[model samples]
Target: MTTGAPTPAYRTSTSQQPRRSRLRTLLPLGLAAWLVLEIWLLTVVAGAAGGFTVFLLLLAGFLLGAMVIKRAGRRAFKNLNEALQRGTAPGQGGGNGLMMLGGLLLMIPGLASDALGLLLLLPPVQKAVGAYAERRLRQATPGTLGDAFQQARIHRPDGKVVPGEVIRDEQ
Candidate 1:
């Protein structure tokens, strides 16, 4: 026979609502704000310069973004192929990923995004951003993702690793 307490007729304080994740709570709000800002900025531009000018700007940004994306993709694939041919691990990431990101940002409608995308395309900006990311990865706490990276770095032929997993067949 079960020996547990009977259920209470009234609700108890122990039963609480599940906490929402920070991303879940804020992402929609952030997207909404960004959309509003983009729309407002586009209207302002349209008022200052005719709608045709705005249309031209959007078309230009889209075309440039597509070109940049194509170039970056080709470069990245070439690098990978060369590394494979050499029978060695791939080289560390350079600006290709960031360039792709910039291209994607440029493709998004809005002058602000276009400006930010252009900035990302700059060599100096890419270097600074790369350095910052490197610093962050190095600074990550032990036993976390940082540890995995450290292990992977040690094993890679060029002492570099991208997204990967290690499996040891323990005997």
Candidate 2:
């Protein structure tokens, strides 16, 4: 005999739609808006300073983005090395990851994204974002940071914890 009442019927709530569906609906709209705004800004700048100036600005932006990407990439590698040497997980709080993201954003060809990338590269903003990410990750996981640090095995398909090790074979 069943021990409890029947389960309620499965019902879909309007607010419970999958995140991918929501993103699919919003992505096109956002892209169109960005294109329109970019075009408008381009026209205004061209009218004020001529087409050559606009071209120069775009070229300058591209150069700046390249430089930012190069610098951020180097810094991220440095941070990763330091973390490894200290026996800690790299990007424990997501700062290095965010820095890489910011650099990639800068690489993208758009004024708004470049501005956002520059902001994300700032030390204060990176710290804030890292803290927020760490908090969210902690809330989503079952164990404390210490437990995560101590974990050095992988759960296999049969539910056995296999010891994890990195092996490099040079031919």
What overall lDDT goes with each candidate model? 0.89, 0.77
- lDDT tens readout by residue for model 1, 1-171: 778998889775645867789999999999899889889889999999989999999999999999999999999999999999999988777899999989988999998889889999999999999899878876875466667766767676875645555689999
Q: Show where candidate 2 strays beyond 4 Å.
A: 1-20, 86-88, 91-94, 138-171
- In terms of lDDT, the best-performing candidate is 1
Lowest summed lDDT window (length 10), candidate 1? 156-165
How many pairs of residues collide in model 2? 0
Query: Model 2 — which ten-residue stretch has the worst lDDT?
Result: 148-157
**Cα TM-score per model:** 0.72, 0.61
State the displacement of the C-alpha of residue 160, model 1, in Å, after optimal TM-score superposition. Answer: 31
